[model samples]
Target chain A: MSQKEDLSLFVREALLAGRPRPEIAEVLVVAGWSQGEVDEALSAWAETPFAVPVPRPRTVVSARDFFVYALTFVALGIAAFHVVWLGFLVVEMLWPDSDGANYWQAREARNSIAAILVAAPLYAWLTVRERRRLAADPGLYRSAIRKWTTYVTLLIAALVFVIDLIVALASFLNGELTGVFVAKVVIVAVVSGVLFAFYLRDTDRG
Target chain B: MNRVLFALMGLIGVVAVGTGLFVFGGPGTARAEREDQDRLMAVNDLARAISCAYDTAVLPEAIGVTSFSDACRPTNLRVSASQLMAGGLLTYRRLSDHRFQICVIVHDLGRSLNSAPYSDMTAGPEGAACLTRDMQG
Candidate 1:
């Protein structure tokens, strides 16, 4: 059993033995468990007075869910890379002196364009598929993995947003706020903002 | 679900068309760019070879050239197609005693022509060329 399972079992046994909840919590805390863990463990058995509660079955992810989620993750990664690459291309096109286009840049721009072409469509398809599935069965929206993935995407978007802000601020402070820098900052902001807004709205709707 | 599938199908169609265009249209531009890069490298190499001959106190004829002044011409030098010296695509001429010009037909103009000793030239479609001073002096 995992440490959490062991802790839950210990908490259940202590509660059944009529030990005071405070004492159980204190002992667990002294045994290196955090107060938060002790409180959570205690709360799991809080209302069970006489009858032993049946353990809830663990949620099993279906193949379809796995496939969609995996595909979405891969698409999101590709989208992020391509978005940054496209930003660089735009910057180079605008400011050729500071950010000149060379053979490698041309090659990268072509590859990134191809990647975005593929990944953006795939991402849209998976997102629409998941949204439709959730609409048909609202309960599916509560799936742990789905929620986790959405939250993780939100986290990444937030991080990118903050990083873009810092980059823009640094560029401004350095007096390097050329058209290229401004364009790059705008691209990053727009992309991350759209991702943040979409996920935030989805999470809220859920 | 049907709507979702239809949208996905539509997206797939768009991607297919985009990929087809890229596959077909990308290579021609790529090949031209590669050729331009090769031409730039060849010009620099020729300049270096001339400088080497002058430094070693050897005649340009020793390196399969008639003379240093006229050696800039494509027919006078031996270089491979990979160096953009094939089919007389590149031309060279000694403008004066201390200056020489290398000319090439480049399709793309957005790239920097910052190759040393010839960085001042602007890329153009008509014919992008750079003049450099003979470094041998």
Candidate 2:
């Protein structure tokens, strides 16, 4: 059998033998399996007062869940991007530079506003619908696609957060940290930071 | 908590869009800006034709469209009816032998007047925001 299969069998047998989880984990660690591997192997079974070890519900693949989650997150991504864009544009308008490019800046603001108008509502709707579904069936949170998409979103948000700070620091070093520039930087941070924090909490909950 | 965030986002989107629309005007503002650009382009074209054919064209008398078209024929530029009707009438006047002025109607004078090329032009009443040029210069 594969090493993973062996690990699973070992964990199940140990649990059935009425060994404490920490003792089993310590034994696995002594055998050179990582703590994460041991924990995953142990967590495969639910803790219950049953005669035998009971398996937890595994992550199921659902096409409908994939579609709903994908759409919801895509809409959210678009909305977040445009919201930051619009916020930057607004800051620029309020504290215009000496070049006086208000006309073009206003035009871009309109486009960002239009994108936000479409995507934000769609995001809100899909999110509300998904929340309702999740409320009705909390087990739906265990879908593999949901976990994957959530991680992907977290990855993007984290990247944005890092990139935003990098750009702000670069601008500061260049001595271009004007009021408008700093405001734009803060806007990006707030938007991406919110997404990162929200999804980080969500993944923890699951 | 998710619902609360969603509601907050929805509210923000609506408010931002409304403020943007109020500040930048609507889709019509973009259209008007384009129309103003086309009108300015036509004015430039008309001025070039006038400068090119100044020797053969009539002096002063506010250079009528027919006369402007006929003078520009030999220079291989035709002042089309559509160009004239794009924004409003294009008017040309010979200020002196070496200088001339062209004016066209603009929908959003405040925006167009602040922009490049147009910013250099002189603001006049509704139908006649004028850009003056010297052929010799």
Candidate 3:
């Protein structure tokens, strides 16, 4: 049918016929396929001594996987953001600024706490459930959606670090070294650092 | 490790919520705050109506059941009857023909409402706060 399908078929036939992978790769490369394409075609099947070539497991595209991972990450984001917000509120309350104990600030703390109460439990439940599933079917590690979501989270965490540094340096230059400001900066750094570390390790495992 | 992290996060959430309640009080405090805000808005509306009426006529001794007067009645004023009956008597007193003061009893919910006309109001300890204004006619 398609050129790539034809290539995969040829590679499978060549492997079953006992043609070595490197020779097949070289033959395809000489026949004008890129080295990557030739390598990919060869690597699609396992290199085992058997009558027929065995196909390596490919990344699954499942709607259920997408839904679970989407909900898990959304909950994680909500919980993380509000935790940082609550930390900032706590800092502000402890170190009184000139304009102290605002009604709005108290209201905001209440709202943040409410969000954390809901989101944190949801995230924990989803993660535990997913972990159980992953244990049963370790092939779920090959989920393309899971990998993409993890990378997106890592990217956001990296951006938060860059922005935090920029703001910290800017505040230092501007002489805004108040206890509240410093504490808030530290809160952001600690939370984001934890997230980045956890997800980075998670991606490695996946 | 994952389980530990999840438990820790959940614990943090609970702790933060507890701290929030400790510092800011609970749902009752929130409800009181909302009631106080509504009281402020109602008082503010009454004041604005009095100021408007003072442009043409003398300030009314008391706000009417619905309207201050046909010309200066506040449109869509949301002051509740219970709020009005409870303490929002909005004691109106005239300093002069063009100057007046309106006082309303408000609960001091530790709200930092220090801005504009509210800033001018002299808030007493857990009682009536009054705002005196001159008509800019």
Output the worst ten-in-a-row residue range by lDDT, candidate 2 chain B.
Answer: B73-82
Model 1 chain A: lowest-lDDT 10 consecutive positions: A51-60
For residues A111-204, write the lDDT of model 1, one tens digit per residue.
7777877887788788787878888977786676776777898999899999999989998899988887787788677667766766776677
What's the best-to-worst order under DockQ? 3, 2, 1
Per-candidate TM-scores read 0.66, 0.75, 0.86
Ranking of predictions according to TM-score: 3, 2, 1
User: Residue-wise lDDT of candidate 3 within B19-132, one digit each (tens)?
Assistant: 878876778887766665566666677678777767766655555535656776666656653356455445666777778776666655235354233565766445666667
Q: Write model 2 residue lDDT over A1-206, tens digit each, in one string.
A: 99999999999999999999999999999999999999999999999979999998888898898798888888888888888877766665556453333357668888888888788888778777776787798888888888888899899989998998999999999988878778888878877777777677678647
lDDT of all predictions: 0.65, 0.76, 0.75
Error of 1 at B65 (Å): 6.4
TM-score of chain B of each: 0.51, 0.72, 0.71
What shift in Å separates residue A89 of candidate 2 from its native position after superposition?
A: 2.7
Which tens-of-lDDT digit does each residue in A55-174 have in candidate 3? 998888899989999998999899889988988877777675533445677788889988888998898898888878888988998999989988998999889978998999999999
Name the runs in model 1 displaced over 4 angstroms: A1-71, A95-100, A173-175, B1-25, B54-86, B97-99, B109-125, B131-133
lDDT by residue (tens digit), candidate 2, B30-124: 77777777677667666766676675444575554455556474233344534574435776666776788887787766666666766777777
Give every collision pair in model 1: none
Q: What's the DockQ of model 2? A: 0.35
